[model samples]
Target chain A: MEIFMKHFIRAVLVLVFLILQSTFCQFIKIWDIMPNLVLAYIISLALTSDDIMYAGGFGFAAGLLWDITWGRVFGVRTLLFMYIAILAYRAGEYVYRKNISVCVIFTLVGAVITESIFFAANFILTHNASFWQSFFRTIVPSAAYTAAFQLVIYNLCLKISKMGKERSSSV
Target chain B: MNFFKSKLFIVLAIVTVIIVAFMILSAAFGFGTGPVSNGLNIITTPVQNGIYGIGKGISSFFEGIGKSGQYKGLYDESQKRVTELEAEVREIDTLKNENDRLRALLDFEEREKDKKLVAAQVAASSPDNWYAEIQLNKGTNSGIRKDNVVYTDNGLVGYVTEVGPTWCKVLTVLDINASVGCVVPRSGDTAVAEGDAELAQNSECSMNYISKDATVIVGDSVETSGLGSIYPAGILIGKISSITPELQGLYNKATIKTSVDFKSLREVVVIVG
Candidate 1:
């Protein structure tokens, strides 16, 4: 029951972020760039998670939900985020996962990677995209904006992860 | 330890292939509006609309407070002006203003009486910056359909891209994928108004393919030419902000400031038929 509760809490967190990203975040654009809160949450969750399957699964579910609700192309975010989770998980093995700075840095890297691939795929498929225009105007700035939230989301995920672990140990 | 041999690595590889295949199929067949997406939207649209309403309310509350002082100052100035003006002259001026405004509204209504328009509130905007689209609270249930034209009182917004049971997505005129057949009413020169990546960020688009020798100039009002079946004629799109020669001086391109203020867009009407 405790384990189920822990997973349930994480699922709820994903939904909240997804809703916030689609709705409230629209009103909070800074310099015409809204932070990708779901991406930030996925990266943070992946970093703090010990199991690769759990990290990948969470990422998959979050991306799938976002794609279904608001994405132009389905499966792109799902694949991108799932790969990002695994990459972050592998990177976490080498670094101290509890470090806030590490989380922030990883988020920055992860955001850039995700945005770059998305842009590339969009450009290839559409053939109407401008590389320099999108890169300077949107991609870099949006990555930084998404990374800014790493501090808060990472800590929240860490706290939740620790809480679940504590309950299991106490039991 | 060979990481490639790990069970988790193998599983991830298989998942990646499946997802990529799904993406290819979705892109090719326009599968983003399939059953899964519709089902999810049905479940999530209410939550999104509710949150959007709350956000709008909170924003409006702060905006109202900020504007109250400005309104107060305007009111005092208007009162002083009213005291200075002759009573008969003031009454005549107010009547003239009201008459002109009513006449304009009546003209627009008379012109659009044949079109079936469904009023909708914006439920949410696209989550990513890659697209400039918004979801409306009304969809197929409300007689809204894909490709239905959406607009505000000011001017053309865009058309519906996808529709679900209770919600629809509108790709605004500011989106890069959008294009409209436009004419400069003053010069009578027709042009194509297309969304630009750089200008869309500023809520602007570009009107292209104007004849180089056309007498079009700055501040010329551009409206739909009705050349295309999608957008009806004479719907005001925007005004020419700047004009520059394009295609080695063969044609001219003018930057247009869209009449509809996308940032403050809340309520819109969709031409269902």
Candidate 2:
């Protein structure tokens, strides 16, 4: 019961943080650009959580919430996010969670993957083969912005999860 | 092991169910004009307005400071020209009304165009996403329905695909899914104007199905045909920026430069057709 309560509280905190991130933090505009918080949150969950199901589950929920709030195609984010969660979870096995640089690198890679999936899905549906142009124009700038902010978000998530664990142990 | 059997499964099931429910609710009822969206709009509107205001202030401030001597002359000249244009526009409006009255007297069936053009301010843009969408200040309560055509005086902007009470998302002509049936005004040649992936860059769209023998030169204007029922007839669509002949001798592709600037779209007109 205590463990369940701790995880539950952590998940709620994650949601709250994401909501704030999406609403505020409009500072990272290089040529008018912003980092994607949904992608960053998914990566954070995969790295912090030990259980594959927990990571994937939270990632899926985050993606669905994103689609609802932003109003895009229904399952597009869900599918892309699930794949990212799995990959991030696997990648986490080889990295140290305490290392900040690893978090940044993982986030950069995850950002690229997230954008690649979006472009691939768009191309598949619309048959527009101008992927290179879009990659250079939008994707690279977005990725750079996401990487720049990943350190702060990753550290915050880490501290929160650590506090949750400490409280659970004390209880 | 026990945790895996009981706690893990419960958490997973709960999260999955929540996600599924959220998706269904959003798809069915449009996420509603709940506090979330309303709060976002309320918070975002001022920021967008502030940004625009700052931009205007800085530009004007620099202009005023730099041209203290010549500024008054330029301003007076421009103001005079503006007044003259305003008078001309009023005169044109009067003549147009008189012409419509004359046409009515001739037993011509007057087209009952019942569209209320509501002006909306742009709230936000999706820079990361491939889809080029704009958030408008007006929504369902303002008669801004789904598939309603949105435009500026310059040309066709986009159509409303999603609407809330106080907000609507315009799927612009630059979006991948948005395809407008356009015609070359000079040559009368028809083509489908579809958005490419580089839409965010304010780049050109590809006009397909131009006949091989069609005389479509660069700088030719394209306008919506109203055949799709999405846009009204004769709205300026774009101008032909470039032309490329297809492999077969059946058709050619033209890159059309849109008239409306997506980067700086402020106020837009929603044609309630």
Best-performing candidate as measured by DockQ: 1
User: What TM-score, to 2 decimal places, does chain A of model 1 have?
Assistant: 0.93
Each model's number of backbone clashes? 0, 0
* Per-residue lDDT of model 1, residues B214-265, tens digit only: 9998999999999887988988998889988776767888899998888878
- Regions more than 4 Å wrong, model 1: A124-128, B68-107, B247-249
Model 2 clash pairs are none
lDDT of 2: 0.71
User: Model 1 over residues A1-171: C-alpha lDDT tens digits?
Assistant: 766777899999988998889898888888889899999999899988889899999989998888887776678888888889888988999989889888888888898889889889876457567777788888888888888888788889888888667866887
Cα error, residue B61 of model 1, in Å, equals 2.6
TM-score of each: 0.89, 0.70
Candidate 1 docking band:
medium
Model 1, position A41: C-alpha lDDT score = 92
lDDT of 2 by residue, A7-116 (tens): 77667755554444433333334564568776786787678777887788777766655555565545567756766886788788987866777877888888887887
Regions of candidate 2 where Cα sits further than 4 Å from its true position: A1-34, A45-54, A125-141, A159-171, B1-115
